[model samples]
Target: MATVPSSSEVPPLAKYLASTDKKTRDKAIKQLAVVLSDPSQVTLPHSDMSKLWKGIFYCFWMSDKPLVQQALASELAEILLEIPSTSMTFDFLQGFWEATVREWSGIDRLRIDKYYMLVRRFVNASFRLLMRMDWEPSSCERYNSILAQRGGPLCSDDIRVPTSLAYHLADIYLEELDRALGISPEPSPSPAPLSTLLNPFFILAARTPTKITYDRIQSVLFEPLFTALTPKPDDQPPSRKKPRLSTPTYSNLIANACLSDPKAEGAVESEKLRKALLRRIFDVASGEDTRDANRRKMYNLWKSHMEDEDSSGQTAVDAS
Candidate 1:
């Protein structure tokens, strides 16, 4: 029977790292530091190497192994920063972060906390990278390819990379790209109208007892909506026709806002706020000309309810 060769028999670089000799180990570490720090060399494909990429990723995610973890993190950061194209770099980092998140579940709480810091670092890095991408047809095609090939949208089996994170990352990527390119980030080809902006607050007031002054309503909600709704002049068609509103519909926005802040306090007030907001949304849906009629009917209904609530002195409604 043939005996397997000891690690000492391997090439000097590998042998030094795997060797027990202090001098050899130190030399290997220094060489690795150089290779890892060099972005071009690090990304070069080493097809014959067994699990080299996986091992690097493992070191990055395993914070319990402090020395290895720090080495990998430093190298990863350096490589990411050196990449010229923000989109490609961001996609790579996002994939890496997703893998790290999956690895996190089995880690101890203390280590998990440290890993969270790494996660934040990756997120911030991704955000910055996104700021540099061209959000044109080419970038969209690239994103669609990644989403389709990675099984990113429908799966969360891997904790390191959840579908929600992937989706949000894509959105942020596109949004930043649009901003950088001076284009509208919205999918619709048209720009939103001013009346569409005020629709939600109208609907919500009719549905609940919450009464938000226009100023508070604008501050809390409309500003963000307007930013997203308003399109760049260059994004409009060459014909100069009035562009249609392309902002997210009221219900979708409400749902997203609620889901975003699930633990927001003052549940009763929150519900009222949502309802008031929804009313404005309905007006938007109904069109500007019809908004007055809708508002009057809603106001009458709201007044009747307010009187009843005041008469009964009921602070909360019973669900059952």
Candidate 2:
């Protein structure tokens, strides 16, 4: 493995990181990960860390072809795992988010999909790092704070942060968590902090700079269910739409099942989290006066679901 240069020569490392030659770029990344994992060996100040991430951002930007991009994204995310210290892992995660946010608006249409993939891989990586720690409360709380707190990446008041990032984060939360924990429809014991897993969401709902972003985030989270309930323009008729909603689970099977089945085996803990998330959405929708048909339809569906459950004499999950 090629070694990193001395601290004084660090500035030029970005060239190596963004090299078209795979072998050169790969060595730079590995060496950078080693330095990050044990910073005492070669101290990198905050500014240098920021610059290195810029190189990494473009490293992905210059990545070739879909398969290569996919592999590179996974490799980049795995850096978080390589770090022996949790504190440095978060620093790296924060650096990644900062670099991405700074450049998000500049991403053009052609390259947008690749950046989206990059974000998804990072989110999954963050979850994997947490799961490795057994979802320790302080670690989860710290991670959530970094992502959703004021001035943080997802919930920052800065308009430059872009609503799409928050929307994407919301879109992937359940999917990635399920993926990270290997969750499936089959009954399995819930992980610890399972109930509080979504506390970041409520923080996001309250702190995100704009209502538009919040609505977008909320819409993405609930869209799977709403989409299942909704029919396409070319639908045959109302009769045919029943099959769509009853499809057991659409693309988001595990999450949809959690919403539809109150007594889902091994879902007691997950159910609490799901209900709280839905309650937040429902409460927000209730306050809006707009009668957009889809919003109205979604509201009614939730209302009916909650009412039926309430009348069934099932104990209500406190969504506080």
Candidate 3:
């Protein structure tokens, strides 16, 4: 008699994930998440494992279930952190973000919150991973492109939460860089510190309120005002052209300042500063000039700054 294939030999995980029933599909997704979480426990062969994950992603992309999408988002973040260099992970994340934005544009407030959290987790993890690998420029561009797109009427509002989350991620990026350079991660605890204007944007973005409030306006719109108002370092030369803030950086700044900081206390003259910075950013963002030209100018400025910092470090090393 011919040998028969057992249930154990079948790809139950993938099959279950692709099921028509919501309950069965969700259970399978959770199981897959667990398996992916601990690869050692996975009994599936390597080839089969690849197929299973691909199927899972397909299901993830095609399904309309928010619960399933949220699960997939968390799993994707974990996967990105677990395997930062995988091309598959990158492709999946890029596709996932695109799909998420499309779906998000059509949802109500509750759904928006759910989608925001899911996307935030993945984006945050990805940023941290990319920074750890010394991949800054690409990371910045990836985030910027996502935010730059104008969704429908809700698009602007929807972008706010993600923007704030991105800001918090940038803080982590800066902290990691400091640690790598053997510097203290903690800034001075002075009253009205520069960080006060910077730290909260990310947190706010990650936790944007479902209900609109006056506080939201202050946190999400006005707080960044303080950051812009505070003087750029004299040593930090103005771009011979315009300088572009990376998406992650810009998002982080906006979220922390505009979305998170409600009271806007500190730096006695913060209100004045906030207004100035807002005006400048608005001008650049809405300038009559082409968007591409504006972006190039911004990129050159950041590129130059990176070059300057690198050169300064090398010089110090050579002298030592």
Candidate 4:
């Protein structure tokens, strides 16, 4: 007698993932989509799943098809919501993340509006995982220190994708921060410090001075710090407790990212953008005012760096 297949045992999605033809691979994508569309499905084995992810990467990397990639991203977003799947995908995290970046980077590439919607899907998916439980995403710490070096080949790739993605991710990151840090009448639970959460993004903002990246860095990171550290009306009593993370994590992360980015090559520009951010960190980190004397002294270090840069600029001018 023939037995019926159990729910735990379904054909692996890898079969279609390996197909040579685009149509066949698309069929596999649709099949994965069908499975992910339902929350009850058990995911395929890790090896097969990685293969499936790599296959998706291969399909995108090897083709000129943005639609295919968009479909994969959309489906991956749903899969993540259903199952904790970043592990399989994270194995190739850079490639996985860069796929969309490369897609949307160039001026003549994907439409910004549509690209924005699609990128929202990607960043949101990763961010959801970032905030889920034990720890924040490690992408930033893993990448920031080395991104400008030859180690960060992707950073050198045009910078447009980084600019665009960084801009949007900042808003989302800050929005999440705001929600986590929003004022409450009673003591509220604060999420863990996003420590390195925005690090990867600030590297992008730092590595290049693209207008859009600059805007996002300023608005998302700087403006929010300013507002959060702003003095409240004295008439209103401080009813809520301070957040678990406080404002320093955000301020320090942005400042460090800016300072860490390599200076522009062969350029005579002053460190205006980087210094502006570092200098403000002094005020923001000062805690509700300059009352935090320790934080005030923190800016002294940056002040010395600014003077050093000024001296170097003058020397260069004299030599020229």
The TM-score measured for candidate 2 stands at 0.70
- Give model 4's TM-score versus the native structure: 0.46
Looking at model 1, which ten-residue stretch has the lowest summed lDDT? 189-198
Better candidate number, 1 or 3, judged by TM-score:
3
- Model 4, residue 303: distance off in Å is 10
Best by lDDT: 2
lDDT of each: 0.38, 0.63, 0.42, 0.44
- lDDT string for model 2 (130-196, tens) is 7677566678778877776554566645666777777777877767765766643334423534334
Which is better, 1 or 3, measured by lDDT?
Answer: 3
Q: Over the stretch 1-320, how does candidate 3's per-residue lDDT look in tens digits?
A: 32322337437776776677777766776665555444343233344554465455445545576765776667656666563234444544554555454444355664555555565666566544544433434544444444333431112345533433343333343333223223213242112222322323322322333323223433334333333434466786664634335312232332222221223432234434344333333334233442443333323322333343333422121101
TM-score winner: 2
Error of 4 at 119 (Å): 1.5
lDDT of 2 at 307: 51
Off by over 4 Å in 2: 1-9, 20-22, 38-44, 183-195, 207-211, 223-305, 311-320
Candidate 4, residue 29: how far the Cα is off, in Å: 3.2
Name model 4 segments beyond 4 Å from true. 1-27, 33-74, 81-86, 106-110, 136-162, 176-190, 209-212, 229-231, 234-320
TM-score ranking, high to low: 2, 4, 3, 1
Clash count (model 2, backbone only): 0
Compose the digit string of candidate 1's lDDT tens values, residues 237-295: 45332334553333322222221122342122334443444344433434543334344
Candidate 4: worst-modelled 10 consecutive residues by lDDT: 261-270
lDDT of 1 at 90: 40
| True lDDT of residue 303, candidate 4 | 47
